[model samples]
Structures are given as C-alpha cells and as structure tokens.
Target: MTWINDIKHTLNKKCAGLAACALVLALAGAPVLAPAQALADVRKADVVYGQAVDARGLSVAQCPSIDAEYAFVMDKDGTVYFERNATSPTQIASITKIMTAVVALDAVASGAATLDSTVTVSAAAAAVGESSADLQEGDTMPLEVALKALLVPSGNDAAVAIAETIGGSEDAFVAAMNAKAAELGCIDTVFENPHGLDDGEFAGDQHSCAADVAKMAQYAMKNDTFRAIVGGGDTAIVVNRADGTKPTIELESTDELMDYYSNAIGIKTGFTALAGPSFAGAANNGDKELYAVVIHSTSEAQRFEDARELFDWVYEHELDYRLANSAQTATMTVNGARTEVPVAAEVPHTEWIDKTVKATLADPEASVRIFDLNGNVSQSLEFDEVTGDVKAGDKVGTVTFKQRNATIATVDLVACEDVAAPDLLEGIGIWWDRLFRGLSGQPQVASAVTLNETPLVVDKTAVAA
Candidate 1:
C-alpha cells in the first residue's frame, strides 16, 4: 500500500510539471509538445517566462490635489512628473530668486564677478520694502555672502544688490534674466524685476509659470556654491573689506522645507498679500530626488504641506522599482547541458522609485534593456562572460534601472548553482550529434523526438488526411 501511494505521488508530480510546461509553451507560441531532448531548452525558457509573469503590469500615477493654484513636480532634466497649472503664467513670488541666483552665478562664471566681489548696496536696493535684508544704503558684502542672504531669507534687497553688481543696474539685470529664461526654454516666463514683487508701478505683478520655476531651480542646483549655501543650516557670513578684515553678519532662512523638513534641500521661499505663500523646494531620498513648486496657497504652512503631499503621492505610485527586486532569481541554459542552471542578482534592489517601465531580454548572453512608457530604452543591464565552469554564488551580471535616466536600482546578477565543464567524451558526443544532424539535411540542432515528420497514426492519434 505504501508503494502504491508513492507511485500515485510520482504521477501527480509528472502531471504538474507537464501542465506548467504546457502553459509556458502555449504563451511562447511554439505550440508543439516539448521533445524529450528539449528539456533544457524548455527550462531555459524560464528566464523569459519568469520576467513576463513577474512584470508589474501597467501603472498610473494618482496625484493628490494641491492646495495651491499652480504647482509642478519634476526631474533635473525638466521632465515633469506632476503638474497643476504648471505651464500657465502666474505669480511665483520669491521663487524668482532662483533665477536671480542663476543669473548671478552665470555672471560669476563669466568672470564679470567673483564670490569675493563686493555688492555695494544702493539707495534703490535698500528702499525696497517687504522681506528686506535691511541693507542700509552703503552696506556691502561679497557676492557669495549676498547669495546666502538672498536665498536663506528671501531678501528683496539682496536681489536688487546682486542685480546691480552683476548687471550694472536692475533694469539691465532684469533683461539678462529674461534672456536666460528664453535660453532655458521657459516659454511662459517673463521677468520684470530681480525679485518677484508685485511691481504695480512697472508692468503687472512679476510673474512666471510653475514649469518655468522648476526649470530655474534645476539649473541653479548645478552651481557648487548655490548647493552649499542652500543645503547648509541657519548661517552667518563674513564680508571681506579692503583692509583684509571681515565683518560678520548673520541671516535667517525662511524656507521651512530646508529648516524643518529633514529631506528638504536648499531653495527660496516667498509670500505677499497678492501672491500669498509660495515655495520652490527639492527633496531627496535614496535615488528619489524631486523639485516641486506650490504657489498661491493661503498660508505658509499650507504650501509646505502641499509640497509634502504632492511628493508623497509621487512616492506611493512607484511600484516598478519594487517589482524588479521580486524576480532576481531566474534560470539559464548551458550550451551542451540537458538541465537548467539557476541565476540571481548578487545584490538586491535597494532604490526607491515609482515610474512606468519595462525590461526585455534580447538573448541569453545579451544585455537586457529597460524602457519607459514612451518606449524609449532608458537603461541596459549587462552580464559578464559566463562559462560553463561558473560556480554557485559567482557574480554573473549587473542590472541598474533608471527613471528619467536617474539610477533607481542597482542589482548584481549572480549564479545560483555550480555548472562544471562537460566531460571530454560528452563534448565529443554532442559534436557528433550536431554533425550527423547537419549532414542529414536537418537543422544543426535536431527537433524534438515527437515531431510528426514521419506521418503515421499510432494509438488513435491523427494520421494523414
């Protein structure tokens, strides 16, 4: 009775294996029964089958409602991941300081000014009210220190002073700002002043689109000094005088994103009766970095809260990165073997990301390509030259998946088992088999033993028509 039970289990196991093979072969469109000698080929097909089965399928990013009238979330390349009135021209308030900093940095890069260069304040710069650095008509500081005052406190005075020092006058500086805007493809942008004030005396309230501000912030991050000043904490700066002495001055950063939020990076904050509270901020976690803007919110806290909510929404929908980690284990075929060898990534997926992406295995030894929703190949994962003697736990390949061309996950493909070289006689036998098949006018590799080429009926199976 025990022997009978063992036989039943064996038959059940065979039935299960055949059922799995049937499903796989059906999807691959081969349709034919897997020949007895084709066991390894069918097993190697698991690599492709595993990927298809484990695919994340289609995903849609569900964005939450932003409290502000205009908002934008983007990558460094200005690829917008989320937007609400992003391209529509509207008030950005003090985020204009991003462009101000950009124009100032460009001037420094062009040798027109240096971080050490002095910003001699004018009556015009000092007189401008609403969030002033309190520059008395003659106060002077280095261009570098002025930047800290401008960005940290969203100082209107510092904006005008940097403009005069770098652009000869605020009008000329505003023109330069517009030119830079055009160069950066800020199609809906226009600048009326170095600061984003409601200059009722000039054109209309100084305005820009959410998308334009995102572009400016992304470009500004390229400057080393800008990155340092923005990412640093509540700071004091020393201004150099001609006599080789330094005057120490302290400043406050109103950017709550930088001051309170742990993940927040350096950027500018702005508010007014007309423009309300607005923020252009960036945050990073692992490989997930984002630049976002929330403009015209009712209060300061609301805009920051909006920034957090928008970012959180973006994070929740990122299952593509998670899916890659799930299927690191797979199988591959050896050239002359009848069984499949297991393979995996030596390193697991550790990047935090969410984007619609796909990967395709071109061939056994060829690299796998990752594609975006636009069907563009965003990244390619390549494997090392793996020979039959590869041992278990050997490093075989590496896969680094990216979103917007930013690496979100890096995994090391590894051998899951040892595959020793075939015996000499076994190699000769394989070569002779290939030679015989080729000489007989068949393929270099013969088809399955069950192929119906012989054209006969047996045991009630089909015969010639």
Candidate 2:
C-alpha cells in the first residue's frame, strides 16, 4: 500500500492534471501505452533477403557465373531470375524468329489462318540466301509446314513466307512484331525485319535485350501449339502442296543445345557478324521450366554452353515454402480495445519440409525469387488504422508480392484473436491515450493498457454520472 501510494504521488506530480487514481481504474485492461497519433503513420517490417536472413538455416542455390555479353533467365511465369547486360539491346540474330512464330501462331489461334492453309512461297521468301528451307519460288505448302521450315532450320526464307502470307508483306509483319513486343513490355526491343539478319540495310536497328527476349520466349511457350512445336526438336514430315503432291522434308533444330542437353527444348538461334551468336532456349525438369537467353557470346557453341549452364542449375535448385517464421497470433486495435486473431494457410508450410531452400509461408517479407531466377519479388506494407470489433481470422491487411510489377501472390494479414468492442469507459481511455501520446511526443499507438494518463471523454457518455 505504501509503494502504491508513492507511485501515485510521483505520477500525479509528473502529470499535473492526470487524475492518476482514476486512470488506473479505467485502464485496468487497456493496451500498453503508445501515442494514438503514431497510428497515423504506417509501420513496415524489414524485408530481409539472402541466406543469412532465412528463418530456417537452409542453403540456397548458388548463382552460376556465365560468360556472355548479354544473358537473362526466367521461370515459366515470366519471373526474371537473373540477367547480365540485360538492358543493353543488341542484334538478336535468329531469336527474332520468336516474334515471327508468335505472330503466325496468333493468326492460327484467332482463326485467321490454319496449319492446313496454303502459303505460296514468293521470290522474296524462297530467295533468302542465309539458312534457307530449300523452298523454291512459286512453291505452295501448308502454313504449318512453312513454320517448321522457319523454326527448325532457322530459315530466313520461312520468315519471309510467314510475313508475306500472313501479314501480306514484310514491313507490315515487322510492324506487328514491334507492336507485340511493346504489348509484352519489351521496352528495349525493336523489330525492323521478320528475320534476324544483320546483313540487311537496317541491320543495326533490329535488336533486342536479354530481358525482352526472355518475355517473348515466355509468352510463346504458354500456348499448347507453340509449346509442342518447340518441344519436338527434330522432325521429318510430309508437307502437302496445293496440287495434292506431298513432299517429305527433314527438319533439324538449329539450336544445338536441344541436341546435347538432356531436357533442353527448341526455341531459336541467331548469328551474323553484327550480332555475334545468340540463342533463346528453354528447358524443363519435373514441374519447373525456364526460359534462357544468351546474345553476343564469343562463339555459336558458347551460347549453348551459357544457356545449358544456367538451365541445368536453375531447374535443379528451386525454392519452396516452409513454415511461417512469425507467431500465429497477432494483435489489432479495434474500437479502442485490443483484439487478437489467428492466421494460417490452407496447408501447413511443413509440407515442404523436404525442399532444399525453405521459405516462410506466413509473414514472408518478400517472395523467394528462387535463387537469382524469378527476377526480384518484393512486397509493399499495408497498415491502416483500424476501429470496431474484429473476429478471429478476419482479414486486416495484405502483403502483396510482385514480380516485374505484376502481382504474383498476396498474403492476407488476418486476426489471430478476437477484439471485442470497447464500452464507454474504454473509449475514454482510447481518446486519453491519443491525447497523452500527442502531449508526450509519442505515437498514440496502443499495445498494452497503461494508467499513466488521465482518460479523455470523446463522447458525453464516457463521463456520465
């Protein structure tokens, strides 16, 4: 009793008008003292990355050192994993065929054209000197057959045929290609021709970067038709002509990566003096698939080497979600009273216990980017002042994880415990907490009940006799 009296005496002297005894009675269950004014500002947790910051001591996959002037890697979801000189645009060589193939495929997808539709090879298409499909002028074959010629052999002639047949001209096809690249957010890309030939009059201007090329590859592979075509590396098929005569042609993949690498998939290859050597390729292992780009490598073989080195490593090492690092219970301010909420995912993160790199499924500051592969995934904090009662597991805020500014995952911040509405006395305590914190230069944010300040009566009922 003596000690309590002494404490009351000291509080009365410090807070001249606080009415210390009254405050103690009102705030018996009040939250810890913080200035309610501080709630006006937002609070964010530090989003830590790297091996040392991992909640669980799991060794992450190491990044491979690639030797190429331009290189980029991404997952199947267009999440860029890594890049070197990815922003600088350079002549893409045969990687240009990806856009050509996409436009042609879009035509088929939209019912504007079909695989069985005839494409009459003109002198422009047939007379292509570099990497020809061996198509003769005036020959007519299925558009599907021409695409095989274009993609498998990396034929400039097939590009011309697709452009002329589908787009009605090469210039128009190039325009469409540029439009598609722009639409896909390829800011540093420009298509001056359907074929990635640097030997043309505008050789220097026809270029793309590793990042842009990765986007094109990702968009193309999502389609079943395009995926099947590229996945089937080398094939021999009979191409029927308009006259009913069918000629058998042997189509070989120009991308050697598919030939030597176990799970390598076909994409496109390019080379010319200005562009050096380039390849946009893909690979798959189990459930993971990646799109890789290497441009301006020292030699043609070096491009494949760089791609394989990246693909094999990325596919083998993937990040998985583990348990939440933070506690399951969380506190929220409601109606001037403190409430608790329970949080959980549909499946316990422990399911990924067997994974190599375990990440948090709950309260993750940032989405694990899967080593250096899925570009950068980050989240913005969402904290707004809350009032009124709340139920357990009720959503309060969110941590939105994004890649390339596109939302990939959103973790709902929910209540782990219930917060009941405050009565009139509690409301006085809340307003008093805010007023005290304001006078003391502290955030009026409530954590636990404190009896240091006199209760404020925001409503008349708070002081009713």
Candidate 3:
C-alpha cells in the first residue's frame, strides 16, 4: 500500500505515468497494464501446524543438500536457520545492487530526494551497461521507476544513474554503499560500483558473501517501495528525453523463482562470468518469512531451484508451534458493575468444555509455549480498565505473541458475558453500605474471578471441580 502511494505520487508528477497509459491503452483496446500485476503470483501460504523442535541440537544430517557454492537462510529478523560457506567472501555480481537500492532509498527517506525526483542517465552510466533497463544516455525518469529498472531487470545502467543522482557520482555512491554495509555489520562486503559489474573499468576487488547479502536483503526488505519493486515481475515505465520524446520501456523481471514456487517473493538475481548465477530469494509461508541467498550456483535456473529447496526443507522440517489459545477465560473487575466479569478470546474455539463444571475465569497469563521454526516465542497481555456496562464478546484487551522481539500475532481478548451498572436506587444503597462499612472499620471486599481456582474433573463429562 505504501508502495502504491509512492508509485502514484511519482506517476502523477510525470503526467500520470502508468495509470494514464493504462487508461489510454484500454480505450484503444491495447494490453492494459496495472502495477499490481507484479504481485499477482504472491499469496499467503496455508497454515501448517507442527510440534515444537529444539533446533539448538539440530544435526547437519537433517539439512537440505543445496548446489550453491555458498548459501544462507535467515529469518526476517536476521536469525540464521541454515548456512553453507555463508561467510566466504566472493564476487556477488548484481546482487550488489541490493545495497545500491538501499542507499538510494535511504537518501529518499532522509529528504535528499523523492520518488518523483528525476535522475539523468549520464553517458558514463548508460555506457557502463551489461544487463540493461533500456535506459539511454541523457534519458530521464523518476527515482521510483528507475528503481524498478534497477531491481526487476537487474539494470546496471539504472543503478549508475541512481547512484549519480543520489550520491553525486559513482565513486561517492560506492563509498556510501560501503558505509551502509559497515553500518549494517556486513564485514566482508565492499562496493566498487553501483551496478555490481565485475569487468572493465567498473571491475575491482569488490566482493560480498551469502551472510552479508542476507543482512542487506533483510534491511532492504523493510522498505515497502524496495520490496514492491523487486517482487514486481515485469512492468512498463516511461522515460523522458531532452528533445521532448517520451518512450515507454518494458522491463522484465530476471527472477524466475515464482515460476515453480508460488510463495516466492522477488528480491534479486544476478549472473557474471566471475560471480556465476546468484539469487537472493524470499518467501512467506503463513506467519513465517525467510530470506535465502545463494551465490555461485551452477546455473541461473538452478539458483532458483536451490533457493526453493532451502525454503521447502525449512517449512517441512521446522516447527510452527501453537503459542496460545484464546478459548480460555480471564477475570477482570468492573468498577461500577455488580461483580467482576469473565473475558475470553474474541474468536470462538470449536472444542467444547464441560457443561456441568463451572469454568471460573482467572488472571490473564500466557500458559502455553509455542515455537516458530526460526526460534523461541514469548507473549504479553494488555487489558483495558473497565467501568460501567460491558457486553458479551466486547473487545477488552489484546494478547501479543512475539518471537525474538518481532511480533508474530496479536489476538483480541473479549468479555464472555455482560456486566451492567447498578440502577440509581441500587447505586445509592451500595454507596450507603460502603459508607457504613467504612465507618464501622470493616474491610470492603472487591469481587474477583479465577479460571484455575477450580480444577477440571473428568469422567464421562468434563467439568471444573
């Protein structure tokens, strides 16, 4: 959604770029284009539940056999799940563009430029080409469109243009890229050019590794604009020439992971005689999201397959533990009501409890332990202060489940039944009784409820004792 606004703002500034073209093409009965088509293949994975596993003692025998020279699989939060030669420094080729995108977007966030800001393709940039975004020398386009060209097609030219626009020159931009890598704790990463080209004048001692690339991917994916652009399959972009000619350039995604894996999220792909075929792939299976980076794979298609194997292996073997169930009740005191009311999960459970046994509510606590394949998870409960009338199923609080400080889910806590305020006469009577009790030096009793105060007793029927 944020990316949508970013694209719209940029397009609106440049004569309604995509949206306007879509309309014109539609009226003329040409192929209609929508930006969202880029994410058409992405969908949430079905929930898969499994018992917890103690991954600390996980054996190498259980790991997937991948074909890459170097590989790393990590959670979005930077938790490493699998690695092979992950720290070995090697030429990463165009995967270096990931950092290039990060630096450019960082400038946008810092107000140095905007998505609508124009970038001129210098002759030096357009001439330093390999994989192209169809940008020609002196051609100009918005930073947003340029990013699609840079990322989707792994455009070397677009990367140079962006670096010059954002960092003033390729040398300066490369310095910024290195600084960003250092800032992100990427020890083995070094950048020589914005395009990640490893030949000619662009070539140097530049290199990175699977571990460092994964770190960059994790950081870059936080930017919605960056994520949308990489995941966007193929798109048409409009660029302007000084002579007043506007040409639409169609950029096709180099990433082929979506062809076989439905949950594949676009990140980046690269190939060079030196770096071989490399891919930084991402996927979200239900609530779990992971990033897999493979460098120097046997082939371009094989790189994607390697990532697929990593993802499939993780989902099949890793745990998706159930952390907490809301079917249980909580007790809370309503200040102006007759007594404390019981609260349960706003969402109902299919399993039924005992009919005869009274299930008294207790103080809210996280009694269940659930594990995500990535790591351990903890929970925190927050409840609203209550007063006056309350209705059944009214939201009263929230139960947040977190894994390694990252929120996994938040479920609403709701009242199980109603609690009404006392009538005027009854209120007066209660106040009088309280005053009498206070004068008599008698300790007042506040109403309370407990779920554990009564234990369940089961024979033929399940009920609380």
Model 3 lDDT at residue 198: 78
Error of 2 at 351 (Å): 38
Q: Score each candidate by Cα lDDT.
A: 0.62, 0.65, 0.70
Better of 1 and 3 by lDDT: 3
Candidate 3 local lDDT, 319-352, one digit each (tens) = 4344333345444434444343433333221111
List candidate 1 segments past 4 Å from native. 1-62, 77-79, 203-205, 237-249, 319-465
By the lDDT metric, which is better: model 2 or model 3?
3
Q: Which stretches of candidate 3 lie over 4 Å from their true place?
A: 1-61, 322-465
TM-scores, each model vs. reference:
0.61, 0.61, 0.61
lDDT preference between candidates 1 and 2, better one: 2
lDDT of 2 by residue, 117-196 (tens): 88887887777666666676777878887888888777677789889999988889889899999999997998888888
Instruction: Estimate the overall C-alpha local distance difference test score of candidate 3.
Output: 0.70
Off by over 4 Å in 2: 1-62, 200-204, 240-244, 260-263, 313-317, 321-323, 326-465
